[model samples]
Target: MESAETNTVSQDPKKQASYNTVETMEEVNDSPVEEVRLTVAITDDPTLPCLTFRTWVLGVISCAALAFLNQFFVYRQNALSVSSVSAQILVLPLGKLMAATLPTKAITIPGTKWSFTMNPGPFNLKEHCLITIFANAGVTGVYAVNIITIVKAFYHRRIDPVAAMLLTHSTQLLGYGWAGIFRKFLVDSPYMWWPANLVQVSLFRALHEVEVRPKGGLTRLQFFTAVSVSSFCYYIIPNYLFPSITALSFVCWIWKDSVTAQQIGGGIRGLGLGSIALDWSTIAAFVGSPLATPGFAILNMLVGFILIVYVVVPIAYWNNFYNAKRFPIVSSHVFDATGAPYNTSLILTGKSFEFNREGYDSYSKVNLSIFFVLIYGLSFAVLASTVSHVALFHGRTIWQQTKASFNDKFGDVHTRLMRKNYEAVPQWWFHGLLMVVLAVSMLACEGFGRQLQLPYWGVALAMALAFVFTLPVGVIAATTNQPAGLNVISEMIIGYMYPGKPLANVVFKTYGTISMSQAITFLSDFKLGHYMKIPPKSMFLVQLVGTVITSLVSFGTAWWLLTSIDYICDQSRLPPGSPWTCPGDDVFYSASIIWGVVGPLRMFGKLGLYPGMNYFFLFGLAAPLPVWYFARKYPDRKWISCINVPIILSGTMGMPVAKAVNSVSWFTVGIIFNWVVYRRFKAWWARHNYILSAGLDVGVAFMGTLCYFALQYYNIAGPSWWGLNIDDHCPLAKCPTAPGIQVGQCPVH
Candidate 1:
């Protein structure tokens, strides 16, 4: 699990030489002499600050102050007054000050006496990429937006802050620990090729290889001075003063105006109608491209949103969509005029809106077409993953070769940095135990715990069923969602089939096999890093720390600064619309009820198995098999990477506008910092690129803290017309008071 490179770097040549001589001499004199070896030599490097009591105290105090300030000045402002701006913008700039002031040591080039550290901060490139991707769509993806919201909504009274915090830290530690146990399978194996790590390493190496050495002390001071000033400016500028995005939407608007833009625009309208049909494969191809411009996938999603906002609700206009007394959106349920919701409709809306609050809600119902498309994607995922796994790894040949190769090259040194497979539970047993605990917790924590309660046997059955079902689907979602938003349909199935048991449903559906799929995927990536000879233990520890921090900090901030009803009502009205709605969940629930009931009824009223959307997902699930088959058949072909079509297709649904100042800003950070590192320490960077990439991530994250506030905390409102105050009474027509639209304007042309 550790890298041989680290062992080599950490080894003390003089001490090791001395010990080797002593041991050799003793052995020469006495054939059976038992001897010890010296591993390192202690030396005082003034800049290599000790991690002593004082450091710990200072670190803790500073972090606590930072945390409290963030919570009070930043988080509280948004939570209380619903502000349009915040101070986190100010806070992130200070990170630059910290980064510059913190002195770091430089390692001497093999024959020289100089050293360097790239940047200071808690995150780095490899760290950020893995952390963000995971948080967004990897194993821990579900833990992001919705999970936190649901927990807060459902179990506010039961959730002790202390317990929640403890649980979070505990789960995180456990995740890290579990990763350690599987490090051999996941990290050191050459075939794993964690491409993300490679990317990080590349960035790091590139930065250092490009460093320009200073001629003298004055030049060195100037270099330092330049770095300090440039970095500070980089850290603060885009975050506070600039507006993110100059509107990339225009690129699609002008060039692809006819088909791509018009088609996508039509798709957005279709979304409002609740049925989206598009060629998944084609969309996948388009999205896989780096920019992911306004292509087919965007077209499909846009149509879905449009149909809902412009058509569906407008037709229901005679019915008051807002006033509980007149035109409540749900016909089956009743509510108090004050907007407090209850009953089946309330349950549906609450759950739906939770997904909404998490950013999955849409104004329209999904037509049968999207439902089938979802099913097809799901089916393809299952088939593709299974066949891929089988073809690539039958009888552990790949695994064995990887292990042998690593052991032959750098295994001994790695053994010291990363522990060997230690005493830990196997994957199956650990998950099995997890299921047991989850079931118990669900029963106790949920409102439905007391009612419609299945017997213990039923609980067992649910867990078993969830485990079995989550495998193919979870893998599909991972592969597909990695590049696109196809998981919405899969989620729909879970919502409707298990309706009312969102807690159990979400936990089971998301956690188990999903975890397995991600483990495999990331393990593959790690293998890539291993092949490239990046230090394994360094990669492992840095990633572990970064993931834990992002989860705790990012999730917490996202939860606290969540949008309110007004925000939702207003945001939903925007022309393009809010990302906060759960159209997928709505589609799933509606399909589940429609199919679960209708399909069975048509087939003679058999209950417990709806299988309608499941079949569609199964198609999606099977779609990948052929592509994978061809991949195996032509393994050497360059297009093999296209197997990630589904992911590319689904992921671009929400690529933060590249033109956004923030987006442009981060890329700027990457460009500038890499240039600096390249100019100052090119050789060292080439050698230790992984760590350097991590350093960049830290720097970027330090900078991002500002934008997070400026964008997320204060200015949560949509464009004015997008807010709730719409002019529904236009003389020519009337508009509904739902999210997204100004009264006088006809919905988008």
Candidate 2:
């Protein structure tokens, strides 16, 4: 299973200095040979400085920068995220520069046994790893942004800054406890490779290992620099100057008046069959690096995407299922039966904000597009299928790992090295931390009852659900790169229990779903640390400190943005081509209505309009039976076993957040790089694929953030010409032609 891309080279100076020269001479002396390989254990040296002052200083700076950049992008129209790899790339050069410049003199602590050097011995790999981990913690999308958006944008209410900060901090830290407890199942297992971290590992080796210029072809560093510079230069074209290149649907341009053309070819409003996107940000929006993902997994996701978008959505819309034609084909905004935006504020009682039944009845009923409805259906399916698939395929192995966790036997070479060299963080430590956070969370829930509307018992229930679902979801994410979310299920349960309380529903969902997902994210990082030979204790401390710092910094930035940006979430107030469309927040607002304001009783009740959709939960439970039965009935058929229903269902979940062009372009790139290139040029692909991905991601993110601040912030327009901002290249793509669709005026044929 090991490839050059996934393997790490030793970073010990003695080994690196001689190995590179010797290997090169041998390659030249002998005929074509297999490339030099190494195990996951990158080095046997045990004196590497991990928790150094320099590490903390760089980490704090990176944490602050990443938190600001990520929070800034979360509010934008595209919601383009800057990955921690950006920090990794930027930190290496900075760390080296610091190592070269800083004094090597040691500082002694009075009345203490501790003495440390400021220079920290050439800024070792362990310190670099810790810094990246710290940056990763800060770069995670803050879930509290949704809470802030809903309160200000929809409820027209303001929360105190202290309360908001506490809420954000508690929710973010609550997951770390769960992550620690599940380390045995998720992190200790050898099979949980966490494919995404492999990219980071590859990049780390490239930066730290001894540099040798390649004879003919580009070296790793040169290729990385070239790709990064090119990607940085190219992103400006699609990001700012020519926005239409992001989604160029030729079909829509050719047949501007055809409704079917608009439906099939419009990247924003339709399946985006023939649409082409030039923007890397758009291509990598929902799905991650195509070069990193496996070809088989991408193919499965594509199948699901086609089935849901092309077949199910179009059929339901054309047939007028739930009056789909009355609304936009795709939108996260909830609408009334008359095609007007549903105003939840009008139906709320004075200050209490409780639902007013009479007011609700006077207003039109809530309606969702066919695509939105399908997202819900698939969400339920994902929940059931993930658990069932894991049990069917991995039950015995999970049990074995569980039993083996208590023993002294090592699972793999990496674990053996870790056990022999490093002191493991005791399980009791994690248990103690979990209990402390649990108590604080409970108190926070009680204190914020008036604002969140969630009682102490509701908080307990949410935590309980998180504990129950964490293992299954974590397993899926660790292996498959897709984590089946608990958002839909949590909302449904809390909506039924505490009906008619929108804030309470979201609060419960936040604790239940977000905590579990965050825990899984932390566990994946723990695994990454293990692969890189970082001590478990140092990893835990860095992650904890980083999370706390990130919460404070992110909250401050969000508060500043909310106060400074007039009409923050309102699109009408922003000028043309403004990035602050708040698409993610809009989706959150819509969910609060469907599951909170309306309540599950009204939305999924026997007399409800979408009552049939409720049966999706039952369908999900049964759907996995056939897949399992086929796998067992024909055990020799390996492909049958590989069909993961949960992963397939994840493909449909992107409808609310991402457009069709993203998926299509992502798949195309994956096919070319992962499938074609890897199969034809295995050595070159393995050596360069992930490095190229990392470089591109970092470059685009760096340039995109720079553009926002330099041009967008100062209101410096690109150009007034159609070529500069061609968002409306195919103007009729959004035209309203069907009956009851009056939002957009269409030209007569």
Poorest stretch of ten by lDDT in candidate 2: 25-34
Residue by residue across 1-749, what tens digits does model 2's lDDT show?
23333323444466445543223212221101122222133344555668988898999899888888888778878676898988888888888888889988888899998898878667778889999999998878679768877887657787766667767877887887788777887876767767677777777777766556667777677888898999999988887788778888888888877777877787877778798788888877776888767666676787788888888888898898888877767767778876667888767787776767788888766788778888888898889888887887788888888788889553555566677788989877778877777777676667754677888898889989999889888888877777788999999999888888888899899989878978988898898898788988999899888888888888888788888887777887788667777888888988999888888777777645687887777777777789889989999999887777787777867776777777888878988887798789887776788888988898799888888889977988677676676453555544433564566465432
Residue 524 accuracy (lDDT) in model 1? 40
| Model number with the top lDDT | 2
What RMSD, rounded to one decimal, does every model reach? 13.7, 4.1
What is the clash count for each candidate, in the order shown? 102, 0
Candidate 1 C-alpha error for residue 51, in Å: 9.7
For each candidate, the alpha-carbon lDDT, in order, equals 0.32, 0.77
Q: What is the lDDT of candidate 2?
A: 0.77
Candidate 2 local lDDT, residue 698: 82
Model 1, residue 747: C-alpha shift (Å): 4.5
